[model samples]
Target: MDLYIYNKALALQNVMDTYGSLRWVRRYTECGEFELHCPFTVDNIRLLAQDNIIRKKDSDEVGFIEYRNVKRDETDRENLIVKGKLGEGYLNRRIVWGREILNTTYELALRTLVDKNCINPTDTTRIINTLILGDIGNFTGNINFQVSYQNLLKVVEALCLEAELGNRIRFDKTLKKLKFEIFQGLDRTSSQTVNPQCIFSKEFDNILDQEYTDSIMDYRNVALVGGIGEDADRRLLTVGSGTGLERFEAFNDQKGISNMVDNVEMAEAEYSALLSSKGNETLAETKKVQTFENGVNLNSNLRYKVDFDLGDIVTCMSKKWGITIDSRINEIEEVYEESGKEVNIVFGKEMPRTIAQKIKLL
Candidate 1:
């Protein structure tokens, strides 16, 4: 597991000097990050610099150096701890301006979002000419997206997660640029016969050290959307339907979603539809944390990235607890240390409910 280090210009500098450990996290819906601990030495300090790039061969993500720390241990050992984020994290440098994408191919909609925010924006000076949107994939369905003054990275990740898609930023060596791509994982679930079924369970002795969570502390099913008006005259609509305990209610304020647009060319009921779409989108983004955290057996017959990869939907069962669920592999953390390397897969993202919990998660 050699880590390739590159200069600020994306040119190969040298391999990371062996030292402590490297914890590289990869995600399906959003940009991932890493923390590398190496011996504190002149060579290591010079090789690891701010704005330099780090990547592993045969991988899509290229991490951007963000923070570097030097520490001296009790044993008189000095070490350098480096931290950074994946390439897609670069989108954090820009914001999503006022835009409404309605009834367009999802691929085109995504490309348009990136083009306007990263490349060829209305504000020419904000353009990142080197970032190119890749060709479309086999994605179908129309999208209605309305965003104003939002973080581009969060918006992109939310949309991709809702749509069950994967996003990446690959460093194109030949083109000397970053290629932004949208992809979907294969359906390797037990019920899907199209490809080989991928199931992880204690029965098969493939799943280990499980930590499952099933909580609805933040779940909501129905949204009572209020757009514009006052008191009894307020415009209102319902996004989802349910009865009794099945109805987890939420109130959505769509005051910014106007029923009227300044231009006459705008279609009728478009704003209303946008408001409804917003409600649905919000609901979809917020869901119960019924996910598990575990690792795969390295000696198992099943192989990663070949039979299953990030974003792939698969079946996981716990015999002791008698719980089985089909979920996506949302994240994977690779640990490389003196003991060797191990990969931990997160079936679903468990959102922390408290500030302290969130900080602990980070």
Candidate 2:
């Protein structure tokens, strides 16, 4: 078989052997969409066993260690086979294979760090920093250092802040803003003079100029909160309804009307109850029912007029009218026959062209 396929088969068997059953393993091989158990085939089982990928258990008789469903009191033989197949397929896919390799590389790095004593049980931050930067000089100490978990977290936070500051300095060139001047006198009697200038003064000035220009443009566009020419009181007045002085009084009247409606409803209900008590039985059966419907109303109209402007009169009398006219020569006809019209032309040169020819088809 292909080397890749063989390796995947072996990997699936190994997973099954490690977990004591293919069904229980978190990652295995599948066929269609990538699952965990597509590799354990009849022909490859013996080969996998020889490679120690699949382990055989001898309990009275030699048998493959299969996953058992404890709840069902049955062996998960089909799931085990399916998982092997899925795992094999996953190994075959190139992207999945690359991801697995990258994962293994990181795992190897972690393992090396642990073995070399660069990472301790408590110092997770130092471990991460060492792994990323490949510098463990600061982490060298006794493994049994009496440090609390919170202290280790603090160290991690401090290291992170240091890294962030270092990155900012590297990218922003903040350190370059600090200038150093060295002055020396050739003779004992000689003197030197030094003058200093602010490095960011020009940059700050440019920023302010741009901000002022932007503010002017914003004011010209429209008034908004925090923008130039914005009237805070006018904006507040126009916020809702825009009725100004009348809004407050109208709101109070509306509240009063609602209260009156509620009171009237209550009184009517109480009167009906009193009537029922007085043996007016038919009044108790009467009840009000309300229904509501939502809909949209649209209206369209077209109006035509003749214009008599001085410019139009001049253009009509002028030798070279100085106007280029667009002619839609085609006519729209609503053809009507004795048996009613079979077709109607609504728009430009209408022969009902294909969708590709329609400009507004979308």
The prediction achieving the highest lDDT against the true structure is 1
What lDDT tens digits, residue by residue, belong to model 2 across residues 93-201? Answer: 1111110001122223222323222233243433312111222223221111111122322222222221211100000122211111111111111121232111111
Model 2 Cα shift for residue 107 (angstroms): 11
What TM-score would every model get versus the actual structure? 0.90, 0.14
lDDT of 1 by residue, 1-362 (tens): 67788876678899864768988888888788999998898988998899888987657579989999999988888989999998888888888887555467666777778888898789988887668887679698567657777898887887776677788888888887888999887788888799999987767877556666777788888888887789998878788877998888888887766555455434546656666776777677667777655556757767878777777888877878888877777777777889887776666643432310110011
- The candidate that wins on TM-score is 1
Using alpha carbons, what is the TM-score of model 1? 0.90
lDDT of 2 at 28: 7
- Deviating ranges (above 4 Å) for candidate 2: 1-35, 47-362
Clashing pairs in 1: none
Error of 1 at 91 (Å): 0.6
